[model samples]
Target: MTQAAIPPFHLAFPVHSFAAAREFYGDLLGCPEGRSSADWVDFNFYGHQIVAHLSPDEAGHRATSAVDGDAVPVRHFGVVLSVPQWEALADKLKQADTKFIIEPHIRFKGEVGEQATMFFLDRSGNAVEIKAFANMDSLFAK
Candidate 1:
């Protein structure tokens, strides 16, 4: 059987406030904003659609999991970038004085499928991870 290629996806989630999300995702994360209305907003997050729907009650949920000795968010979203692009983003984050939950660093160093990864939180407290693989194909390698 032929394996189906993985393509980019669209994601939509609830947000407490659009104003806060706009400033955090658009201004801080540098994601370009697209079509929007009073009820929702769209962000071009690394070529994916991330729609923030207005829902104040759903704002405070937080989920976690243990990873690399840290409490990583289980309910989170992020993008996989090319190595150079990932480095560039790390530099930009450093320049912006962003606080990282997991600072950018190499993981599983010298091992098969080693990668560079980092995690940080958005204004609404949503955790986001940005990672790069030495060999892109290793992304799904065991």
Candidate 2:
């Protein structure tokens, strides 16, 4: 069987300011800027299309659920990166003094789905998570 190229996914989320979103996604995270307007901006987020729309009232994460001893934001979206990519991003975040809701650590350690993960909020309080699996096959392990 031939493996097909995965189609890129698109997500639209709220942000209070385009400047802040640009800085966070474009400058800090290294996502390239794409089509943009006064109300919204598109970013090349780890090869996916993510657009930030100006929406003050609906911008921040509002609820959380306890997961493996952390209060994980329920409204978060993220990408699964390689271990090295995860480590580098974690280091960059630390250097930027980014406050983490869930600091970088192994989740589900010594068990199925073991992974390195971190969670933080953007300038508009939108929660974002970045994680990596030591064994990529474990990503959907049962």
Candidate 3:
């Protein structure tokens, strides 16, 4: 399937503070702002609607699962870009001195699902994973 054929999805996640959410989602991630209120803010996250709802008690990732030798955060969200775009974003993140939960690297090398992936957290402690495959068709290969 083509990227354009994938419909945009909506997500509503917790954030500890609106200010932190704004800087992380709006400024750092470069997502454009949408409708918002004092309790929540919406961002165009890579073409999808992701709202950051202020809820201090529910803002952090607390679970993990093993994946390719990494203790991958069980709760995370991100978009899949083309390899070049992913690499560019990785570079930008590195230049900003972003602390990665799992530094960017290719997983499943030489396997059906080989892909470049990385993990990091937003200021609110929400884990986010960004990835890209050498061949998009391999995204769901088994």
Candidate 4:
């Protein structure tokens, strides 16, 4: 028997400004723009649908938790990419002088669930993480 295909997820997040969201999600992250209105915009985030609603009062991180000795934002979202794609993105982000919350590096090295991960905030202060696994099978190990 074969497993069913994964359905695309839809996420709705708040952004302080639509223009900043456009430049971050649409231009920098390369997520194609889908639809837009006076108060919200939609983006194709790595095959997932994400809508950025303009709500300055609801934007930005409010708390964090420590993980692997790093202060990870309590509220964040991202996608799992291939190692090569992650590396290319990391390089591109670095070249753009992106202020990283946690620079791209290997996590859990020499152990189960080893992966490359990075974290940064958008112009509106919403946290975003991008990660890649050396072995996809290890993604669920331990």
Candidate 5:
């Protein structure tokens, strides 16, 4: 589907602390806050719903899958952004000196569905990926 026609999706994930999630997603990631409750908070993550639900005990889990020679988080979450915005965010992350689990760079370069992507861990250890497609049509191209 074309990027503009791609529908947004809702995502709910466990978090160890609401305050920490707030700081990581809201302050650090720059996602705007939305409806919230004591046990859960929502962020408009690139037009997607990312509700961080309180669950301190579930915070310790970590799993990975080898992808493109890197150990990608098996239970991660993230969103696709326009190319320009993605580049801008990459620059911002660089300026902020963000410690990335996978640094911002092109993946599958010169191949179908070529994309720019970066991965980083949140304060609570949740892995997040932010990616972009030079041509939105190439996003799902195969």
Candidate 6:
């Protein structure tokens, strides 16, 4: 769906340092900086709002679950982009030498929910999974 067709989401996550968050999200991922303060910062994450707060005590992925033979992060969040957008972002991340927890590839091949997916952690260890569906309707397929 188009940005105007869906409601934008707000996510509040923890970060160790605002500088790291700014570099990773703002510069690397190309998210635009929004409101911020000494304790937190917000970014326009693909039209959604994501706030990163300085909370060392509550940061990073804590567990994982097996999915299609890979250990998918249990505590992670990210966005669903178009296939072209996902491919472009994947290339950009690779060029930046971004350490991917799960390298970019197609998941669930020939099955429902098939998509292009990649998982990586920010400098502060916040796990993120960016994915794209060839068919957007597959997002919630059963």
lDDT of each: 0.84, 0.94, 0.93, 0.92, 0.85, 0.94
Q: What lDDT tens digits, residue by residue, belong to model 1 across residues 41-91?
A: 999998889999998776643777887667777878889888999999999
Per-model TM values vs. the true structure: 0.87, 0.96, 0.96, 0.95, 0.91, 0.96
Error of 1 at 106 (Å): 1.3
With candidate 5 superimposed using the best TM-score fit, by how many Å does residue 15's alpha carbon deviate from the native? 1.1
Candidate 6 TM-score versus the reference: 0.96
* Candidate 2 clash pair list: none
Model 3 root mean square deviation, Cα atoms: 1.1
lDDT comparing candidate 3 with the true structure? 0.93
Q: Could you say which candidate leads in lDDT?
A: 2
Superposed on all Cα atoms, model 4 deviates from the true structure by an RMSD in Å of 1.8
lDDT of 4 at 81: 89
Better of 4 and 5 by TM-score: 4
Candidate 4 lDDT over residue span 8-125, tens digit each: 9999999998889999988898999998899889999999999999999999998999988889999999998889999999999999899999999998888888889999999899
Quality of model 1 by C-alpha lDDT:
0.84
Clashing pairs in 4: none
Candidate 2 matches the true fold with a TM-score of 0.96
The lDDT, on a scale of 0 to 1, for candidate 2 is 0.94
Error of 3 at 90 (Å): 0.5
Clashing residue pairs found in predicted model 6: none
Q: Give a tens-digit lDDT track for model 5, residues 3-58.
A: 34657799988889888888888987799999999889999998888899888777
List candidate 6 segments past 4 Å from native.
Answer: 1-4
Candidate 5, run of 10 with poorest lDDT: 1-10
